[model samples]
Structures are given as structure tokens and as C-alpha cells.
Target: MNRISLPALFITLVLTALMSATSVLSQDSPSRVLRAGAYAADITPTTFPVESSGSMTRRTADKAHDPLHARCLVIDNGETQIAIVTCDSCMIPREIYDAAKEAASRITGIPTQHILCSATHTHTAASATPTFQSPAAENYVGFLTEQITQSIVRAHSQLEPARIGWAIGNNPRQVFNRRWFLRPGVSINDPFDRGSDRVRMNPPANSRDLLQPAGPVDPEVPVLAVQAIDGRPIAVWANYSLHYVGGVPADSLSADYFGQFARQIADLIDAGETEPPFVAAMTNGTSGDINNINFFEGGGHQQPFEQIRIVAGDVAASAQSAYQRVRFETWVPIKMRETEIELGVRRPDKDEIARAQKLIEDAAPGPWSDRRLIYANETLDLAKYPAAVKVKLQAIRIGDLGIVSSPCETFVETGLAIKQLSPLKPTFTIELANGYNGYLPTPGQHALGGYETWRCKSSYLSVDAEPKLRQTLLALLGEVAR
Candidate 1:
């Protein structure tokens, strides 16, 4: 190198600066935690309401609106910059998820790994999962995706430091086991036994049963509330094992019982007695075997639509009870962990496949539902293995409070597992938080064959996903804490 004149020296300095600028432009900056806020958009589903339940119209009505729900949560927990959007829909194809993540990244500098988008698994809402390939909902999905991304961006702009709290309350009575195992040649539903309606129910299948009695029950209603320092409710999320969707027959889009309860939380909090700008984001937990108003059990509550309000009241009461009795704290590290774990999907025996073909050929009835029959027929050609299974389990530690996400419809056993092993003084599990992959049964429950135990064709993972998932979640908790 040679000494340069003053003019040459200045030119060289400018060139060096330009080179450095080019290098910086070529790569993304080292990621860092950022501010957070949330925004929600309403895209409620609609259809002509038919009098399936308690409606003034014994005939029908036109275009009854069903409420769909969605929310975006921005978390700057000091570890990862995360943007989570929870939608009350069927499923959002992996593409929508990726696009949403990309949008969040572009708008807020959050990486896809840091962005978590999930479905609430409401049948009443528009289908996000292209898995079923609905030509009708395609436009709705696109519309919803944009809305969600915008919500994330808006929330990011409104980011502020917030304190979070966790509380546990028992609405244990509301959720119950829906699965009943038949003994070797037992009734699926006992007609002799007095039904909830006094009218007996015919057994679904009364022959060649192996087991007896009702199946498992998960009674965990995990409540996690987040509030700003100013005492404004940022969001209230809940997980309870109650399968109470009412499974609407028509097109009317509604968030079902879950949305009703969520609104109840908002109502309770927004009464000016507590705080303003509070949002309630409720999730479903291990409700694979749980239901609130059973068809054969309680004569369907005699009230259908009101069931939403009824459970909403229950959740509101429980949440208020928890709020009144619980303590609050902040400044805890929130760590979210998700893993792709392979589960053992069902593969019927070769003989059974052959037998099924023969039965179909003979025009004889099969032992499975139309869906199940289809699954069985296609199981052989099933290219899916390792299931690309993704379980999003998260632990948010706020001072002494802890909140964890059980991605599956975790069985009540799964919640107990978290509570038993969690290092946090108190931990709550929020269901349907991350995504919906159907039921997650305990090891033994898998032995009892039913809808809950029926292996999904997509995940093709283990029926015994609960225990292993619980252990893996605990390990993630350790990593985040450490």
C-alpha cells in the first residue's frame, strides 16, 4: 500500500463505505426481540339457518350469520420475536402459514420460526386447510390470510411492555368423557340404561365388543391472562376439555361455544369495572373425548344456541373466580417450543384389507364410517409417513406464573402431565393453540377403538402421542428456562 493524497484518500474512504453498505444489504440483520401488539378481524360465516335446534322458526331462516374469530399476538419475550395468529377455522394450508409468516417478517422483521399461526378447529368457520380442497372457501381463505397478516403488522406497531399472569380454576364439571368402551360383545350404547332423556338410546354396535364402561375424561381448564402495566387486559386465553361445537349443519358461520366463552371473558373484563382494550382468545384442550351437551346424554340440553351462552357464562364465572383469587406478576421469559415428531399411524392388517375389499365387492356393510372406510381403502396407497407431525408446545414464564401450549387436542392426561412435571410453580395448558391435528390419546386410551382413537390419515403418527409429547414439552421447558 502507498500513501494517498487528500483527494484520493477521501475517494477511497467513500468506496469503502459503499462496499460495507452493499454487504449489509446482502444479508438480513441478526434477529432480535421486538415490540408486540395484536389486531383481530371478523369474517363470520353465514348460511340459511334451519330449525335443527331451538329456533323460533320450525321451518327455516335465510342467511343466519355465524361468527368466525381470529387474533394475532406479538410477543417480544426477549428470546424470540414471535407473531402468533389463532384462527377459528378448519386448517390453514402450509402455504398460507408460510405467506403469513413472510408478511409478518417483512412488516415486523420477525422470522418464520418465530411466527406461530394456528387453527381453532371450528367446523362452522371457513376451511383454512386446503387438505379437503373446497372450491367455495378459497376466496375466504385468501381474504382471511390478508386480514391476519395486517393484524400482525398492526399489533407490531402497537407493541408495548406487558405483564402476564397464570391462574388455575376448576370448571371440572363442564367437561366429561364421551368415549365408552364396549366389552367383548357389549352394547355401544345401552338401551336398558336410562338415557338422559328418559328415552333409551340404541347401542351404536352391540356385538363382539372387547371392553366395557365409559372412556377417559380430561378435566383441565387452563386460564392464562395477559395485562398491561396499566392494568388493561391485553388478552385472555383459556384451554378447557369440553367438546361443545354444536356441529352446526347449515352454513351459518360461528365460533361455536369457544367464541361465546371468549366473548364472555371480554365482556367481563370490559365492564369498566376492570380494564379496557382487553381481548379474550380462548383455545381448546384435550377435548377428544369430552363434550358439554351430549346428544344421547342430556337430551341435547333442550336448548341448542343457548348452550353457547350457557358455557360462556360458565367460563366467565370461572375466569372471574380465578381473577378474583389469583395473584399477578410479570417479567418472565416466554419460550415456545415446537417439534416434528413421528406418531404411529394405523395400518390395517393385510388380511383385513383383503376382507374389506371382499365386503365391498359383496355389497355388504363395513364396520367403519364412510370416512373411516375411505381411510382404510386408501391406507395402502398412503404416501405419508413420519407424518411431518408438528406439535407446538410453549411455556411462558411470567415471574411465578407459567403458561404452556399443548398443540393437540391434548387429553386431560396431557394437562396433568404438564402440571406434574412443570418446573413452574403453576402451569396451565391452552388447547388448539398452535394447530389442529385431531385427537391426542394417552397410551392406554389408544387401545380403546373409537373416533378419538381413529388415526388421522395425514399425521400418520403414533396413537400414543400423549406421553411422549409431554416429555418432549418438558424438555423444551428446560431449554427455554436455561
Candidate 2:
């Protein structure tokens, strides 16, 4: 063996030690920590005489029975961050949704596409659409957009070490299929025709003339629980497939059962900590064809507030059960993906346009009192839109949980189909997300010819829109899961 110089040997040993130390340091460096934050902004309008635009009738609310809010939950895991915002409104128009998201994105570094903004579909909330424009409505819209952005900013600022868990439970009793097939000779007339429809939406429950439901009900209530490092509850986001429980005092603004449900869940959890306490949000599920009314037994005579309390309590119970079944994990992955789908708008034929014009012309020059007149106006409004509309579909994967959101009032079957096709074992569908275009009825349901299938502003999408949206959402879900 040849003898090596002592100085050269010392230099070689030192270099090796340095390389080893660097490797050890790289291995020992801390990984990204999971963080979460919850925030709520009071979006209730201070101005009086606000337009409430869910029903066909034109109504304005002078007072609010309960406070309305824009609730936000932001989660960040080193590589990705997502913000979920739930607002109390009948349906946020796409224009407002986009503006709000842009504002929030500018305030926080989170991309606008990553923010999943949705409305609670509460009929009693303030109207933000140009169709229902009023002095109060315009002011409320401006206020709401600013407040929503503020909510996301507040949430991002408060990010702290946190863990999240999710669980799913069922509440089949509260939700029922709103559309039902009628017995022979009981068909109702379609909007443009004097003939009868095979099925009618919200058919009288007591009527012996009705057959089975037209669609299936989705009863899964998925709850995502976020807790601080010390295990204190930070936020609880729950989703249910029941439409708004009406019977609220007329002309009174309320968050519908959605607002009640969230407060009740927070109380049940006893989430009392920090200055802001815990925020609970209830997002609408695929309930376009679902409601709280028990059509089988006919309408119940429960008082207005009583109905809200009962429904809220029942939903809170379900959420609590799901909460108990979940296991919080501090280390997980967060991912978000969004896709824009351009769909053809269903256009009316010449004959339909003539009928719509005739209806509008024949009406007396005044506020609309009849539902038919309102629908006729809606038809004209929809006819003025472009041939195609672009909608956004978003999928967020947080660990093992997958959440898919859409802008339409999706039917329960469509939601079920999404969950069935999703790569995630248990997926949740959030309807009226990003914004509300109209009711999205499956092609099969459209063929059945019911209230939801009527061609108007509220249900103006093309017959093939549902399948197209479903496929796009599934693709996004798969991308995020991968």
C-alpha cells in the first residue's frame, strides 16, 4: 500500500464530515405543519327595505328576525391552502361570486380559484342579483362582497396549529323528495301548454291522487371538524341535503334553517374558547328536489319558529353523531383544483319567445302579483342571455376527504351520482356553490316534466347540462385525489 500525506488525509476527512453533517441536517429539518382558521362576518344589511328573491312574488324585508353571516374556514398545509366561504342568501349570482373571490384573493395570497364560495340558499336573505335590483339590494351587494373578502382575510390571519377530521351520518327523516308522480287524470298543465304533467313538484301530501316520489332523497350529513393542537374545537362545517324549511314569518329576513342549524350545533358542542369562540357553518347539500316537508303525511301544522328549531335540532344531532365518530389528524395533505366548463344555454324557439312576449305585453303595467307573470318575465330575462354560459367546478382534497362544489341547485340524484363516481370513499356534494345559475335537473327528470324542469330563469340550463357538469366535477375530483 502507498503511504498518503498526513495533511491531504486530514483535508479529505474534514470534507467528508461536512457532507455527512449537511445530510443529517437535511433529514432533521422540520416538515410543514398543519394550520387552520375559522372566521365569520356579519353580512346582514343595515339598510331597510331589502328585496328577498326566492319566491316568484316580489317581496321586501324591513326587518331581520335573525342575523345573517358569511362564515369562513381556511386550511393550509405547507404546499396548498383552501378557503371555504358560506354565505346566507337566496342565491349569489356568478358576477357577485367572482368579484368577491377576486377581492379575497388579493387580500390573501390564496388563488381566487382555490376559494370555494357558496350561499346557503335561504330565501329570506338579501337579494344580490340584478333581476331583483333595489336601492337596498345594490347596497347590500356591495356590502356583502366587501364583507366576504374581509372574512377570508380574517381567517387567514388567525391561522394556528390545528388538526382536522371528518365523519358522515344519515338523517333521512327530515328530507323527502319534493317531486311526486300524480295519479291518472291528475296531471297539471305545463307552462306553455294547457295539457297535464306526469309529475308535480310539492304535490299535496294528503292527496290520495299522488303516487310515489319522482326522485330519491340524499340524507348523508358530512361533518368536518377542525380542532386546535390542544384539542379545542375551532370550527365544525356540516353539510345536509335538505332544502330550506319555509314557514318563516312573512316578509321577515332570516337565514332559514341553515343559520339556526349552525348556531344549534355550536351550542351542542359547547365550543367556547378564544375571543371569537368556535364558528359552525352549515352548507347546503344536493337538495334541489328535497325539502323538509313530509309529503307522505301532508304538511305539518308546526308553528314557524317551532319548525326551524325542530329541524335545526334534528340536524345538529346528526352532526354531533358524526363528530363523535371522527379522529383528528394533524398531518395531512391539502389540494385544490378548479375547472371552467362552458355549457350551451337552452334557447327558446320562436313560438316560445312569442308566447313570452305576449304574456309580458298582456300584463298590466305594474308589479307582478301572479306567479305566472313572474315566470313569464323570467323567461324573457333568460332569453336575453348569451348562447353559452361558463360555470366553475371545484374539488378540494383534504387528506382522505373529498369535497365537490357546483354553482347550481343540484338535484339529489345528481349529487348521489357524483359521490358514487368519486375516487374518495365518502364524498360530499355542495350545491349553490360559487354562484347559483339555476336548478340543474337531470335529463330524465326533465323528461318527466315537473316544476323543476320548466323553462324559466330559475331552471334555464340545457337538458344535457347536468351530465356535463357531473363529468367535469368528477374529473376535477380525480385530479385532486391524484
Candidate 3:
């Protein structure tokens, strides 16, 4: 404004240029920052005498041995955001998950499609979906929905600059194929009085009639770990293809090995108390035909919850070993793609329904003791279902790691096939995600005629579901990889 020196003017001009450049750099820096947050929201039922799921008989739990949780992890890579949640329940219906996602999306600005909600398949948790003889507890379902929504909102609010890494670990000792082919002399009878079953589920342990496992087990333990910029653990999400290790007292509610794995992993990794407590979620993988029972060995009698602790400890150790090998990346491109595919349902015909009605009318008035009567009731219920259902499938890409989800109790072979054929080098599939669509046995497995192939609400998906789901998931993986 006044008469200034030429040198001063030159200095002022240079400073202005520098300031403009710095502003541009600052604006662009956000794209390089990767943010993550996690929280374990308690979803344990407040009231007692809640109905428990995952059994053929009606059972109620008066109290919880351990608290259940909806473990949530939210990840954002500047451009894309995703939330992954694993609830400690046997199986959650699609309506519940849809409601939670919509509520979370309204608050967190995350698209409903970007959220992947799954059940850990813990058999002792309060029922949220009617299965077998267990009916859904209406009050608990509402409470669970609110808790799941809050978990995502809280996790989103705690987002901070974080790094992530993943690795695959091996724990072949824990996973065993529960379905087995029996000897020729041993009779395999279905609930419908048909002795045509080629395979039997949970056959007598160490029985001479047991020939060999009907299917192979997936021993791969895939772990995805996230940590803050200062190296504090944010969350660890691990997957294993083993059904729940059931040893909980029949009268008590528990999260089974899934909850124990979370605690064990937190302890193993020294993830002590922090501001936003660390979360570890053990997701159920493709374990429809897999379980912890060793049909080959005469297993010793384990006290209540002893087997749960043992399996959890061993799996946590495997996760820690993989955690040690992780090479955390400060930022990586994140991509998630979701799609829905309609599949046919295995509905019972009129003749089958008539037979089922007759069986129910003739049966004694009490809890069902005969498997034939139980399946007959299932036939009547399945008759009311629609001819088709739409299953949701999602694929996520975080750097080189890929994850695909199926809303079913998927078979181990399907998972293995997906891993082998995925465009990504190391891909893992999460089962019972987004919704409950019943058991997904391969057509070949269905041909073998086993408990998993029985026509009920739990196994009503068409025989072709496995192949269609596999193809669609791989296609989704291809889409995200690009």
C-alpha cells in the first residue's frame, strides 16, 4: 500500500505462492488417511427365561453365563466406508438385520448395502429367529436391534487414523467334519422313515460302523486386524470353518466359543482396557457340515464350558500367531459390492403336507420325542413358505485381502472352492451373513441324503443354491478387484 522495497515485494509474492501450495496439499492429504473404529456392544438379554435356539426341543435359559455382544468394526478409506458386525446369536433373520442397517445408515451415513451383519452361530444365545422348536423372543429381538444399531454408531463416532493387516493361520486340530459315511451294515434312517440316507450327522463317536468323513474340513483361520496410528489394537476379525463347540449347561445362555475367542484373543494380544475398548470377533465361516466333535476319537467327558475354553484358547493362539506376521498398511483402497440373487425354495408338496398333518394329529401332546414327528411338523411349516427367496451376497476388497459373504450355513466345500477360484490370491467366505437362508449344501451333498438335506425351514434352499451362490460371489469378487 505504501512505498515498499522491491525485495520485500518479491518475498511477499513467494510467501503467497507457498501458502497456496500448502493449502492444496492439505486438502489432498485426507485421501491418504485410513480410519478405523471398533466397539463390542452388549446385547445380552435383560430378562430371564428366554427361549434358546439351535436345538430340536424347546429350551429356555434363566440366566446368562457370559454376556453376549454385537461386535462391530467400521473402516473408512477416505472414499469408501464399510461396517462389519458379528452378533452372538444362533441366527438372525433378514428383517432384524435390515432394520439395524437402516438405523445405522441414517446415523453413520454408511449405505445399508455396505454393512455386513452376521451371526456367530452360538447355539446357546437367546433366540432371534425361530428354528426347530425354539420361537423368537419378541422383546429381545427389539433390544438386539437397538444394540446393533448403537454399536455401529459408536464405532463410527470413534473413527481415528488406523492401519490394517491380515493373514491366514492354520488350526487343523480343532476343525473336524461331522458328517460321515457309515458302514454298509449300519442303517441310516431319515426322519421320514426312509433308510436311504447315505450319510449321518454326528454319528456315534468312535463307533466301528463309522467309515470316513463325508466331506473335507477347512482349517484356514483368516484374521483381519486393525490398529491405531500409535499401534493400539482397534479390532481383530477372525474366521474359522468350525461349528460351535457346544458344552454350555442346558439351562444357561452363553455365547459359546465365539465370545470366549474374543476374550482370549484380546488377552493373547495384550489388548488391555483402552478408551474405546478393543473388539475381537470370531465369525462363522462355511461350517454347515463341520463341527468340533471328533467322530474318529473317543473324546473324554469335558465339564460344562471346558471345551469352549479349550477351543477358544487354541484359536486365539492361532490368531495371535497370524497377528505377529501381519504387515500393517497405513492406507489401502477399500471396495465393497453387494448383490441379491433369487433362488428357489424346497417347498413340500400337498401329499407331504397331508402326511405331516396326520402325523402331528396322531402324536402325543407334549414336546416332540420322535424325529419323524418333528420333521413332519417342519413339512407343514415349510409348506407355507414362498416358492423362492432372495439371498444377499457381498464381496469386500481391502488391499490384497478379499472377503465374500453368504447368508446360509454354507458347506466347507463351497468355501474351499471359492478360495481356489477367486480372482484375489487369498479369499475367505463368511457364512450366515446379512440374513438367514438356511443350510447351503451342495447338490452332490444333497444327493447323498443327510440331516443337512432334510426338507425343513433350516434346509429349504434349493439344491442348486450352492453353485449359484458360488458363481455370484466370485463374480462380485471380480467386480471389487477391478
Candidate 4:
């Protein structure tokens, strides 16, 4: 037996006791848990003969083929809480969105900044902007606010210990770049201008007739899966870039493929009455110049409701793959930050404004020659009001996933750039969030000249607005990540 010095023995005993105490403390402490809940509210118009927004032509829908909803998902990581609400509407105007968010914040105790609201951009949905002062449009705004607020509150009340997983899956076959580059001398003059555009929207589907696509398509379908602590799924939120998949009959209000896709996903996951109320949502992605029409194959010939089913099935499969790939985390950091900026509207020059006024004044009030001219008149009307518009940008960091949202119809390239520059590993962009300010095309695309770049109420932002919005969103992402 070796003899040990008294001081050495004492030191060794102290160290052992400290290690034992540390182990006991670590074992005694409770593990932090992630909590999540989902709720959806029916926001379909109650009154009949409602004007559904989309084209320059006014369309009234007395019936709804499918139910429209305001879906919400609430996530909490012990320290921070985030509420993501998506509405099936053409556009949620800033005023209405602000009111709804404020009410939700008060009811749920989540900060107004923490609530990120977005629109699914379904053209068949009721108009929420109230730009035309139509009775149905104006009344629907109040109804929409109440439904969304109730959704957030209900989600908050249902929060339970849960695990979250995020993944990105590719579905490149569905979405296509809508803007096309026509062959030389194939440019046609739009009603807004006598000048012909080198690049135009929805060119002939035949490849031999067109040069190529003017832009790129973002085929990424990002999914966030929420599951109970016992491994039961609660909800699946997926984002895609294709614009509305229109297959509805005339004068019919619907959520289009978004509502269909959610139902399909829920069924695929087997979320039924036996299990917890499982909610699924498909949020609109950066698709300012993207849509479901595969011009390369053919245009205007797609079978009506069949295409929606096909697209929904494909997206559901992609969601399943993504869910399988991600590793669910029970505890993770969650943070949310928002920023608001005012950007000047791109007003028409005096000459163009005068011409538009003259055209509207000279024509009879019955009907205009072309529908595009009506949009031109709307531009002049808007010019008489505000010179600038406020844009809301938000960023949320959940573990390794980063989500950035913009109120404008963002372009695919902008979304890609944000994802690439994000500090978080997997980033996704949500467009038409909080409010809708029209298409946000890059300056380079603006130079190419297309329907998206045309200066009208539909897309009224200044030329530099895209860059400004991009930089602001990036900065917000960095802040939240830190």
C-alpha cells in the first residue's frame, strides 16, 4: 500500500465531492421543452355576391367551392414565442393586418412583433384590400380580423409540449417561370404602353416560338413539422413558390390548391379525429414571376380541377420526404424580430398621368375598351392619395432554421439570395406577409421590362425598393440569429 500526503488526500476528496455534486445537480434539473399548437378559423365570406380579387375585371362569387381559412401555428421554446398566421385571401392590407395583430397580441400575450402574418395569394379568395370601397370587400376585412384573432388565441390556449423538425424538399416539376423572353420582333405592346416588351408574361407555350425563360424557378419546398412529445404529429407547414393553381368555375370563391394541399397533407399524415386536431398549411413562397403553368409543355390547355389534385399530391409527397429527413428537436432557441420601412411609390410621370386621366374622362363610365386600362385608372387614383407605402419585414430564428417574410410579392432570386446569406443553415422566404404591396422585382428584371415591372397600382414600388427590402430583411435575420 502506497502512502499519500495529507494535503493531497484532502484535495482529492474535495474534487470528488464537487464532481458528485455537479452530477447530482445536472440530474435533478428538468429539461427545457418546446411547445406548439395549431388552430384554423373559417374566413369564407358569409354574405353572397362577394367580389373575389385577381383580374382587372370585377368578379362576384355567390358560392364557395371550398372553405377558406385563416390558419395559425404557435411555437414556444420556454423563453420566446412565435405565432405564424396565414390567411387565404388575395391580399391582407396593412391596416387590417395591424389591427388583427394588435388584438391577437393582447389576447395571446405574444408581442405584436412576434406574430408573423401572411397571405396565401389565392386569386379566388375574397378581396381584403377594400381599395374599391365595395361593400363585400369592406365588410370582409372586419370578419377576417376577428377570425384570425380567434385563431391565434385558440392556438395559444392549446399549446402542448412538442418537438419541431424542419427540412427542405425539391419539387421542380410543378412550378415554372411565368415571365418569358420572346424571340426578336415578337414583342407585343401592352395596353399600358405603346412600347413593346422584349420579355412578357405568358408567352406562347411552344418552345419554338419563344427564346427562353426570363427568370429562374425556386423548386424548394420547405416544411416544418410539429409533433407531440409522444411522437404524434400535430401540424405540418409547407412553403412552395408556385402561384395560385386556378381551376375554379366562374363566380366561385375558393382557396384554390392551397386548401386542397393542406387537406391532402393532413390525410397523408393520418391526422384524424382519433388524434389531436392536426392542422396543415401551405404558405405562398417567393413567386412574383412564377406560376403553375408549365409554358414549356403547353399553356391555357391544362385540365381544370385535375391539375390541382396532381400538384397537391406531389407537394404532399415532398412534405413527407422532408419530414422524414429532419431530426426533431425537443428544445431549441426561438427568436422573432420585425422591421417597418416606408418606400416611395413609383408614380407615373406627369405626361403619363395626364394621358391616363384624359382616357378615363373621355371614355363612357359603362365599360373600358381594355381591362388593363382600368388598372391604369387605378394608378392615377392612387397617385392622388399617398406618395409612399409602408412595408413590414420580419425574421424568425428557430434552432437552425431561419424564416424571413416580406409583404410584397417577392421574386425567387431574392428568396434564394436571403437563404444563401442567412447565418442559419436552412432558410425559407414567405411572401405577401403582413400586407400586399405588389410585385417586388429586382432592378435587373425591371430593365428587361415585363408585365410585373409595369408601373401601375398592381406593382407601384420604386425601382430600388427590391434592394432596400432585401438589405433590411438580411439585417433583421442577422439580429435574430445573434
Q: Report the number of the highest-lDDT candidate.
A: 3
Write down the TM-score for model 3.
0.95
- Score each candidate by Cα lDDT: 0.58, 0.86, 0.93, 0.85
Q: Write the per-residue lDDT of candidate 3 for residues 67-96, one digit (tens) a residue.
A: 999999999999899999999999999999
Number of clashing pairs per prediction, in order:
22, 0, 0, 0
Please give each candidate's TM-score.
Answer: 0.73, 0.93, 0.95, 0.92
Which digits, one per residue and each the tens of the lDDT, describe model 4 over residues 1-482? 99999999999999999999989977886447789999988999999888788766667799998899999999988788899998888788878888988998988899999998899988888888643322238767789999999889998999999999899999998899988887776646676766756788887676776888988999999999999988888888899998888887768888888998989887777776535588889999999999988788785556656778888899888888888897899899888999889888887778878878887777778345474567567668667757788888999999989999999888898998998999987899999998879899999998888888777656889889999999999999999889
Q: Give me candidate 4's TM-score against the actual structure.
A: 0.92
Q: Rank by TM-score, highest first.
A: 3, 2, 4, 1
Best by the TM-score measure = 3
Quality of model 4 by C-alpha lDDT: 0.85
Ranking by lDDT: 3, 2, 4, 1
lDDT of 3 at 366: 49
What residue runs in model 2 are displaced by over 4 Å at the alpha carbon? Answer: 1-30, 130-136, 194-196
Q: After aligning candidate 3 to the native by TM-score, how far in Å is the CA of 199 from where it should be?
A: 0.5
Residue pairs in steric clash, candidate 3? none
Q: How well does model 3 score by local distance difference test?
A: 0.93
True-vs-predicted CA distance for residue 445, candidate 3, Å: 0.2
